[model samples]
Target: DQQVKQNSPSLSVQEGRISILNCDYTNSMFDYFLWYKKYPAEGPTFLISISSIKDKNEDGRFTVFLNKSAKHLSLHIVPSQPGDSAVYFCAASQTNRDDKIIFGKGTRLHILP
Candidate 1:
């Protein structure tokens, strides 16, 4: 079973609009939620992160939220830009358990002109 899942395979948002990507995980032991962005030719890079102890974390135009009870998390990008188009992946890890990180299927975000 996939511990982490991205329900939406793709999402499109107009320029200057908010882009929200959702993720769900089954493991209650997960302590960290991470969002990664992958360009066409580059490996996925860390975008944002939220710890289980906190409900939300924000960086510039990017924000990450974690809902422990719902076993869900989301990444939000404000004023989506064309340059923001990329494949986004949601990941979860139990830092106390081991080094293994579970990744979602990923969602392709299209920033429309």
Candidate 2:
């Protein structure tokens, strides 16, 4: 079974609006959470990340929040733009096992104009 899961296979958001993507994990040992974005042909790139010590991490238009007790995390994009349309993957891993990560099925986000 996948430790990390993205229930929604895709999401649609209006341009200039907020886009919220959710993720959940079954493993309680995961202490780090990360969001990755992938374009049509390019490799997945790091978008945002959070650690168990903190509940949230923000980087410019993107923010990631982690809820340890719930084994949940979310990625928020404010003022969604057309360029933001891509596949996003939620990933988790234990601090000690950084090399072995669990990734959820990517969620395809579409920004409607």
Candidate of highest TM-score: 1
Model 2: per-residue Cα lDDT over 4-69, one tens digit each: 999999999999999999999999989989999999989999888898999999999999989889
Clashes of each: 0, 0
> Model 1: which residue pairs collide?
none
All models, RMSD in angstroms: 0.7, 1.0
lDDT of 2 at 88: 98
TM values, all candidates? 0.97, 0.96
Whole-model lDDT per candidate? 0.95, 0.94
Task: Report residue 87 deviation for candidate 2 (angstroms).
Answer: 0.4
- Model 1, range 1-113, lDDT digits (tens) per residue? 99999999999999999999999999999998999999999999999988899999999999998999999999999989999999999999999985698899999999999
Q: RMSD of candidate 1 to the true fold?
A: 0.7
The candidate that wins on lDDT is 1
